[model samples]
Target: MEVKDKIVIVTGAGSGIGRATAIHFAKFGATVVVSDINTESAQKVVDEIISNKGKAIVNKCNVAKFEEVENLVNSTVNEFGKLDVIVNNAGIGPNLLRTHESRLKDWDAVIAVNQTGVFYCMKVALQQFLEQGYGNIVNIASLAGLKASPNNISYSASKFAVVGMTKSAAMEYATKNIRVNAVCPGYTESALLNQLIGAKPEMDAILKSVIPMKRYGKAEEIADAVVWLASDNTRFITGQTITLDGGTSL
Candidate 1:
């Protein structure tokens, strides 16, 4: 329950929510494994953690690749002897487009990272949890996964699959001491959202106008939810999706 001294792995730790979550864990005294597709970025996170007097290691990993995911898990165990929690946060948002006009390649790319990538991480973490008799997994889905987004079919569809996967995995591993859950963030302030708004500056105001809070969610706010879900306080909770969307879904 207490993340202090626990071995935690967070994918996509290079930036945004992933970076925030990694730092959050370290701040709680967890021994973190900072993994990202970019080795340089991962190392920078590692350095930051070290500078702050936290224990951490860096792993260059792309969760979309099954082999890379496997290596990430294997190396964690080899280095720390056990894994306590894993955050499946690596995902990509495709360009906005009507479903009928969407490119096959775009759809495939979104599914590969957002859907299949979560599966790969879950698969490996479940196996490790089974062996260890306990583990925690927090997946980052999206508000799009819960509600329909008119022009973003591929992104929404992939995230919807993630929400489904979270529930199914939680049911299967309930009695095994492996708790699974998802966090759906709505219009979070992150590099991913920045890129989207950069192309369509008007969306910056249009998107925020809908949220009841009248502002975008913060990465640290999402990280707080994720860390809590991973803690002992939520042990009895599983097979659930915690939506941090600033009341937009309402």
Candidate 2:
């Protein structure tokens, strides 16, 4: 369970689940690279980790952009010497209306951040892993990926792509000492959801009724699963997705 001295990168480490994961890994003694588009938000977590005597740094990056992602890995290795794990946790929800009704601008934003962003992070990380001889990858997909949320075409499609990428990449490098996997969460209680609920509580209730557990998920719970996947304890496991849905997919 000890990842002491291991350098791990967490995208979207500004808030919500990403922030939680960054803090959790730092507490576990990992040298954390906290990456986010907003330096202000990311620095807050880095400040907290440093205050507690954990190793961390804030990297202002937008994963969708290749230049930023490349710089992110390079800076981490420059500062920490090597990278052992990466959490492709940066993603955006569907901000569009419907698939057909989606504006080009909205669709482009979602695809770039959610789908392409995962590819960018993994591609760079895998190259580092090849040189280092071992690596661990944890991708954040969603229950929307499995359930086909028609109303949220952009999000569902991006998450589904994440699942596909994790499995395919895992197979390609399974013998090369790289472990790739995805974590699919249900309607977790997060800042994004709170905003959504505030805008449309009635619609939220309708969606909540679909969950058997009938409640929101906490960020810490998801952090636990992500940590386990990155640890040596799950070495034999790869190309698999662990769902955190409240039996909603069942």
Candidate 3:
């Protein structure tokens, strides 16, 4: 699935790995649709991609809202004329607290963004893919999805759900010319991690130590895996998670 010249949509393109992945797709010769909760952030990303001479559009959308997600997909197809890939990267982590002690709001927020959001994006992407007879999905599940992340029960639960959803969908559509896969990044440097680190330094330190690499993964590194998964390189790959956790899962 050479992404070059393809129409791609990436949710949470405002910052972090999503931002990097958006730019990477553009660099690979794809026309990108940048969607985010913040209009300003989404526009900012669009501008940067344009400044780099890449084709892109900014679409402000809240993935948790079905209507917004629908609009995001419709607008992309309206502008680009076709859809080829969708990267569901928008997600929120849990507050650094035990489940019983954590605010219920935090729990709900994590589930809505990290899990439900994936569902919305996938639903829309799959519709277009089935109609066109081609598509690819690279879900950004977390290292937490496959292992325990103490004090972040809500976050872990949402990611784990994403993993399950990706596999189920992949199996359902393996013969539909739509390849679905996920990437489980280990302690990637991102806004969510920074926020959690601020709230609990010791917890962050423990996470880094568990990784065999003993450091946080970079956004571009994760983006690399995402690109491969969306390209012809991984044509036979589906219903699998390429876990790059520096041996954390081992």
Q: Model 3 lDDT vs. the true structure?
A: 0.90
Ranked candidates, highest TM-score first: 1, 2, 3
Which candidate number maximizes lDDT? 1
Task: Mark the regions of model 3 whose C-alpha exceeds 4 Å error after superposition.
Answer: none
lDDT of each: 0.93, 0.90, 0.90
Number of colliding residue pairs in each model: 1, 0, 1
By lDDT, the candidates rank as: 1, 3, 2
> What's the alpha carbon RMSD for model 1?
0.9
| Candidate 2 lDDT tens digits, 76-173 | 88887889999999987766376778888877898899999999999999999999899999999998777768768788888999999999999999
Residue pairs in candidate 3 whose N, alpha carbon or C atoms collide under 3 angstroms: 1-232
User: Over the stretch 143-207, how does candidate 1's per-residue lDDT look in tens digits?
Assistant: 99999888899899999999999999999999999999999999999988998899899999999
Best by TM-score: 1
Candidate 1's C-alpha runs over 4 A off are none
Clashing pairs in 2: none
TM-score of each: 0.98, 0.97, 0.96
* Model 3 C-alpha RMSD to native: 1.3
